[model samples]
Target: MAEKFDVIVVGAGMAGNAAAYTLAKAGVNVLQIERGEYAGSKNVQGGILYAQAVEALIPEFRESAPLERHIIEQRIWVLNDKSYIGTHFRSDNFNEERPNRYTLVRAQFDKWLNGEVKKAGATVITETTVLELLKDETGKVNGVRCDRENGEVRADCVILCDGVNALVGSRSGVRKEINSKEVALAVKEMHFLPRDVINERFNIQESEGVVIEILGTVTEGMLGTGFIYTNGESLSVGIGVIVSDLMKNRINPSTLLEKMKSHPSVAPLLKGSEVKEYSAHLLPEGGYDSVPELSGNGWMVCGDSAHLLNAIHREGSNMALTSGRLAAETYLELRDKGQPINAENLKKYNQKLENSFVLKDLKKYRRMPHIMLENKQFVTMYPDLLAGAAETLLRVDGVDKKTKEKKITKDFRSARGIFGLVGDAFKLVRAWR
Candidate 1:
């Protein structure tokens, strides 16, 4: 005899935990299977957790979760090889009682959430991998088959929340296989520093942190960005280049990260830090376009498996949580209404996603990836030009101000021929719209 469940959720990350928690609390028997030693053992994140999305699922998380800090400022830096032109936005309003976001270490945060799922009555089994979806003759998925012998376990529905890799989906022949262009390889390192050192370097007090997002030369002209995020006593610094770009440039993403840490503007902040942990993972960069059929038969997909990341905002955890919650909600609704899980009914998942920012924002930026790829100037010439223009104006040269203005204009025009410059500007403006 094989064990069975009302709902079986695979992967146990944010999405899996969210779905399991919701279903179990709603009185549905749910089983969660995780291949990691523990829930977050395989998890990796830059650690910005959006408060509103998470609080909706676990309202008291802040009271107990191991949070690093609350972000009160964000810096966007457009960099040249040796300089940066940037903008910083900081607000005291964010310091109020219910902060909008928090930085969390995935290893601790996911473990805590998994505990909550168990407390909500979900059966969680770790070190277990679901190899395939068991389907009946009618092509309806009835359960998942684990790696163990005779591991078939029946369930009304299965949620696939496996992070980023398309192992199950590719094997299932659901969507066209993911290609290099649809993904990005990101490498990150954790730097250990004392809490006071971190605060002083970023110019913040306890519990307040800053995030720096860098673009341009950081990716070696690849279509991606580099970032530095402050945690309580460590910093998360990383760089991601489109997998296609990585292959074409023949550059390892890890090498790009080392270059970023050594950047003149970036090095000073980490003058005395020690590297603590180094990890690399694939990020689904295909945006709205790469998402496959999210639901089929009795099986549904959420989180990275379905490519539910908002790469533009460096938002993955939030989407994972929201998608997981929506999946569980959809499941409960159908079960209460006595409907069998099938493609027709599961369409609700797609509809709900379309209504939310998950799909909408991706749609808005649908053209950005292609645009950036085609016009490499956005990553190379533009950043250098911005820095050069600023330097010319700010430097106290003996030359007249008019000469400086003319020199800046000439540099810009020569760097990006006048017509090309105008065309690039127009394309960028239109893409954002």
Candidate 2:
């Protein structure tokens, strides 16, 4: 006879861990199955963990989780070849007791979270891949099949927390396979830098770090973004491009990252830094337009598996954690009321998400991806043209202010043409609105 769990959660990433942890804390028998050699071993690289979301699952997690650094500053840069127009925000309040966010390496964070779930009475099994869902005669999901021989387990409810590949959800017919355009291929490298060097360059004290989001010429006109995040003694720098664009352009993501690192505006900060590791992963950028069925009879989807990433803010882990927690809460409520797990009841979970920031923010930025993809000027013409204009205006050539203004107008018109400029402006405002 196979063992049974009150709830079976697939994929031990942020979403599955959150769901299992919540369910186990409620004293339910939860089994978490992960395909990686260990939890998070599959996610070779990623960003910092948002404080509020993880803290919501484990209130005192701060005291125990292996956090990298507290983010005290954020920078946004629009880069041209030799110059970047940017803004930097540094706050003392961010260095206070309880920072809003902290940098994290996914490998370490997921291991810690899995341990927490185990401590909370959940059974965690790594190197165990969930093959497919087992349904009863009535076509209701009851359990899952595993790669291991005789590895069949039953549960009242099953959660699919898989990553972007998300086979379980697809196999169960909960959602369709994602298109290349709907996904992003991200490449990142960890550069080892001395603690003092990081602090000196980024201007921060111990435990305080910086994050820079770079756009424009860095991606070589590709629809993507670049990022550099400060860790304790290393810098995490990466660039992501739409997979479809990558396929069309025949440019590798790693190559794009290399180009960004070598760009005149970006090279100086990374000078003398030693590259320690390199990794690439898929990111869901489909926004509100691509989300599919979130729940079904006795089943639910969370995290990248459900296409929940908010790429505009470079936020994925938080959304995953939030969705996972909500799924677990909904399960507990239904179980407590002795209600049956079916399609009709699981709709409540979707309803809850619609009212939450997860869905609201995605809806708010629904047009951003299409807008960015359509307007290459945001990535190309604007950066170079603006940099040239700035250089021309600031040079001590003894030119009059009025003459400089006329020269700038002529330059803008010459670069993009008047009609193109107006069309771009109108498209930007319409898309944003």
Candidate 3:
């Protein structure tokens, strides 16, 4: 005889832990399984946590969570070979009692979140792989088959929170295999530095942090971005590129990261730091069109497994946390009303998402990924042009101001003609709209 629970949450990542924690807190017999040695052993992120999402799940998270630093500054940089045009927003208002965002180590944060789940009465098993979903005679998913001997456990519903690869959902024919063109391959590193050194370099207090988001030639003409995040005593530096573009150009991701690190605008931040960790992970970059079926039979998918990534704004974990909470709330609502967890009833979950920011924001940016894919100028030619314009305007080399302005105009026309510039502008507006 196999054990049974009300729900089985797969993959103890952001989505899995959120669902399990929510369901277990509501007195549902939930069992969460993780294949890693611990909750966050395999998790990788750029390390920015949007507080509202987690605050909704665990109100007192700040009291015990392993948070690294509260972000008080944000920097955006567009780079050429030797120079970058950038903007910075730093506010003391962000240093409130309850900060809006924080930088964290994923492994530490996930482990802490899982601890909270266990405290809420969920049964968590690590080092266990859920091979596939077990379905009943009528094709309803009823449980999961794991690697352990005779390891079959029944459940009323199964929630797949698997990461971007989504092997479980793909293998069980629940969702299509991830498209390479719709995904990104990101490589990250943790560079350890002294806490005082970090604070001094970033020009911040002990509890404050800074985040830098980079675009332009750092990706080597690929559609991607680079980032640097501040932690307590280390820096999270990484670069990501679309997998399809990487394959098309045969560019090594590590090589690209190394080149970005050596850039004049980026190299100074880590002058004396020693790299302590290196990691790589896949991110869902397909935006709205790549999303698969949300629910069917007795199964529901959320987080990266459902392709719920907002690549335009670089947000994934917050969506994962919110989607997980909503999925659990949907189940609880149905259970309270004595409704069955079937394909028809689970449509409510999709409806809830549509009404929430998750789908609304994704829909708003639906055309962005396609636009970016079609316009290489946004990442390449524009940065060079902007840098050139800035230099030409600023360098007082005995040229008249009017003549310099004409030279700038000539450069723009030479690089991307008037019609090309107009078309690019139109495309950008359409995508944003």
Best candidate per lDDT, number? 3
| Candidate order by decreasing lDDT | 3, 2, 1
The residue pairs that clash in candidate 2, if any, are none
Candidate 3 lDDT score at position 243: 97
The C-alpha stretches of model 1 lying farther than 4 A from their native spots are none
Point out where model 3 deviates above 4 Å: none
Best by TM-score: 3
Local accuracy of candidate 2 as per-residue lDDT tens digits, 1-433: 1998988999999999999999999999999999999998988445877999998998888899988899988999989878988889988989888888899888889999999999999999989899899888988889999999898999988989988888887886767888998999999999998999988988888999899999988788888999999998889999989999899989998888888999887777788999988888989998889888999989988988989989888888999999999999999989999898898998889988899889988888898888888788889989888888888888988898789889899989998899999988988887666
Clash count, one per candidate: 0, 0, 0
TM-score of each: 0.98, 0.97, 0.99
Q: Candidate 1's residue-wise lDDT over 1-433, tens digit each?
A: 1878998999989999999999999989899999999999998888689998889898978898889999999999998889999999999998989899888889999999999999999999999888878888998988888887788899989898877886766666665667898898888899999999999989999899899998988888889998899999999988888899889989998888888888999999988999989988888888887888999888889988889887878888888999999999999889889998898999888888889888888888888777877888899888989999999999997989999999998998998789988899899988787
TM-score, model 1 to reference: 0.98
Q: Candidate 3, residue 251: CA error in Å?
A: 1.2
- lDDT winner between 1 and 2, please give it: 2
The alpha-carbon lDDT assigned to residue 413 of candidate 3 equals 92
